[model samples]
Target: MGASRIKWHVVVFLAPAVLVYTAIMIFPLFNTLRLALYSEADQVRAFVGLENFRRLFGDPNWSGAFWNALGNNFWFFFIHMLVQNPIGIALAAILSHPRLRFAAFYRSAIFIPTILSFVIVGFAWKLILSPIWGIAPDMLDAIGLKSLFAPWLGKEEYALTTLALISVWQFVGIPMMLIYAALLSIPEEILEAAEVEGLTGMAAFWKIKLPLILPSIGIISILTFVGNFNAFDLIYAAQGALAGPNFATDILGTFMYRTFFGFQLQLGDPHMGSAIATAMFAIILLGVCVYLFAIQTRIRRYQF
Candidate 1:
């Protein structure tokens, strides 16, 4: 009787959280998906069933922006994978060094950017890089590389990559701290034993430390994957809703916004917007599933 009562108490306590989550998150998510199958008719909603999705993907008027945004989104993910992860690992390794002075200061300095508002970082970088502001040009000229400096964010060839690098600079701290903590969790005796076995420096790191930290690296990789896919605020703040110059920096987030809210000249189409959102959700879900099933399974055997 007492055990049953205790179970009931646990259920009662947990019910609120579960209910709230179901209502706020899961419910809304599923509702939005359902809404994607609908279209507004004379301000009254009606089920259209895949018509919105077909139009988004098949209609030329909609397809160009959809494909463009999706392509940019992938490039954004690629930048984080290629640049962010390696740099973060290197920073973590440097931070883990025993002889390093002012370790706390370094960690705090590195992480401070991650704590700032996206609006601040985005606008600050915009001003610094703005050709009109001349900061980038002046800094480049000081280094005798002024000719190499261009209005990167304003150029179609470089806009997406520039925004990506800015994001990497701001957010690399997360992976750095995570990897650093993982490195610290490793037993000192393991390193000492490796040194005893004539493995030191690069070899010690590669052979001993690297293997042990692989799991943390894996975790960081997955987190980066999720974050890059969901990214929006930085690009939107810096580039505006249009992601100009002439949609040069357009990504899925900005694309979704444009579709949902409409810009100065374009009319908002909620049905198509919902379709785009559904597509983004599907892609993210697919990535997570692949990681969980394929990459995560491979990681577990190597973890111990």
Candidate 2:
């Protein structure tokens, strides 16, 4: 028999996607890395190695902002991880019940926020939460909880966490849907067997369905990490470029934007911006790598 020929058609089919990805993602990533390695002086760009990074970590002026923003970013992510994902899992569990009514309607309503523009969501929430001309205080008063009402967005102690909660409200549907899909994909036979074995209800879910959905949960975790780290639009729209009330809501994304674009009197520093971007990239990459290696590897995929 003659030797089999290589499949040229496969490469042809992939060429367009590859080219587009390279142009939009890979090229920009490498260019940013390259930019991070250089320093600009007197209209001259020079390769200065890790000086920008050193300044980011060592210099008090830069390090303070960098660390604060970074810490806020982590807190933002932690809220979503703790509050959002657990709520999503519970909601998904409830919605995925075979006997549930209006599942479609509920799903659509829950997911509606995810489709809304960040600008609309941010601005709308800002107005709704505003002390002046906002309905929140009135609604709370109606329920006899008026004292709980505060200008959450304006308070430094509450701003970041409140924004994080708002983000959670908008994005919880994502993890719910991912988990719901994973749950639905489980075979009827397995669930039936579990029921027969007296493992119905929450017990069945914890023993059987939960393990099966771990992969999807892991994927959602990584995605959440990436998304939170990359988040900017909502904060920018609601809090402005400063991420104020004393920069309490400042995150890596907004920090990078301010550094790159020069907010107020501060001059734009591309190298420093690139350094921040690189750091963000490294953090995300490290997270993905850890999830893939540590979590995914440990989760056993069952074939049914």
Candidate 3:
């Protein structure tokens, strides 16, 4: 009877959280997926099976925008993976030095931007980059690099890449802090053993510290993937709903927003918007599944 009562208590404790998660997350996700299969026309909504998805992929007008946004999203994510994570790892390595001075201050200073509102960061960068009264040009002029200065935000070729770098600057602290914590968790004795064998400095990190932190790096990679794919607010705040320079900076999130909620002259489209949301959900799910099954499996195989 006592053992049975323990099982009951466990279920009782878990029930509330399960209920809340179902109500808030699971239900809405399934509902959005269902909504994606339906369509509205001439004041009526009807179940349309996979027609919407067909149109999204097969129709020329829809395919172009979808592919463009998808490509840009990939590029945005690539920049972060390339520039942000490596820089974060390097910074974490520097900051984790046992004899480093002002480590706490440096950590706090680096992380402060991550805590600021996305809107604030977006607008702040916009003002600083504005060609008319901005300081970027003047700063470049002072450094004898004025010839390289241009209205990056206004140019199609530069806007997306520029925003991506700004995003990297604002969010590098996340990977830094995460990797920093992972590094600090390493057993000092293992590092000492590595040093005893002539594996010191970069050799120590490359061999000992890095292998143990693979799991943490995997986690950061997936998180960056999800966040970059779902990103909306920063681009919207900086580039507006149009994602302008003629939609050069438009990504999945902004595309979905503009599609579903209607922009300037476009009509609201709940069904089509739901389809976009569904596609985004599928892409994220596919990525996470790939990481879990393929990448993590390989890592574990190599580790063992």
Candidate 4:
């Protein structure tokens, strides 16, 4: 067959996916961006240009909630980086050890939480940590740290962090699985050579395995960035629309939901809601670009 005909086959195979993606993904994205440009007038849509953007950033009432949600979202991402990622790496390292017994069982056991629904996971954790339930306090008392067991979810000082920790507890499996796959992809012969060179055990991991897996870890970090930024369901399930304890857990997702759908006494503002979604899209895009051009380019992956 001619090159044109051959290329057409590739096109044919990809056509279904392209159509589906365009209908479900690209169309909605551009539609939202389009919506951000318009305002409702007389129950009709009117093009408002950048007026919505200005209102989002310039109006005190809107700006306060926007900035607060943005800040809280960043903190949510930061907590995952500091706590969830390191723990996942540690677990992956342990699980990837050669000849480790029950590694499969252990991985499955740990990953079970990741497959659970957000509502189920969030509510279960909420109940477990509820002070009235006394489960958390009992565990703390058993460990002689009962004094440290405040009603974390109810206290504004700790609510966001508490919810974040719960999120981390649920999603750590993703990073662990990703890192484990990366570790397992390393060649046995390469490791054997490292051993021959007297780079055994911890030395081998530091000198060889870690460098190889840095790229994978980088990928995991970017994925975490995307997931955390788009996150809203868990926070919603655990904290409700207000994200109370005085809105401490309010992130972009919940904020957008509240703004779009109208909650409590507030009226729904479609123009502003579209603007918020646009902002979230921008934030996620910016993060992905930074990862790609900044951090990702700096990470060197060695071929086995």
- Taking the tens digit of each residue's C-alpha lDDT, what string does model 4 give over 58-149? 99989998888999999999999999988998999999998999999999999999999999998999999998999999999999999999
TM-score: which is higher, 1 or 3? 1
lDDT of 2 by residue, 1-304 (tens): 3358767887899999999999999999999999999999999999999989999999998999999999999999999999998999999999999989999999999999999988999999999999997599999999999999999999999999999999999999999999999989999999998988899988998999888999998999999999999999999999999999999999999999999999889999999999999999999999999998999889997776
lDDT, candidate 1, 216-292, per-residue tens: 87777778777877778998899999999888789888888888999999889877788888998999898888878
Q: What would the TM-score be for candidate 2 when compared with the true structure? A: 0.94
The parts of candidate 4 lying over 4 Å away from their true place are 1-15
Ranking by lDDT: 2, 4, 3, 1
Between candidates 1 and 4, the one scoring higher on lDDT is: 4
Backbone clashes in model 2, listed as residue pairs? none
Error of 3 at 280 (Å): 0.5
Query: Candidate 3 on 1-304: residue-level lDDT in tens?
Result: 6654567767899999999999999999999999989999888989999988998888996888888899999999999999999999999999999999999999999999899988999999999999988599999999999999999999999999999999999999999999999898887888888989999988899998888878778889999999999999999999998898988999999999988999888887888888999999999999999889987877753232
User: What's model 3's overall lDDT?
Assistant: 0.91
> What TM-score, over all chains together, does every model reach?
0.94, 0.94, 0.93, 0.94
Ten contiguous residues with the weakest lDDT in model 3? 295-304
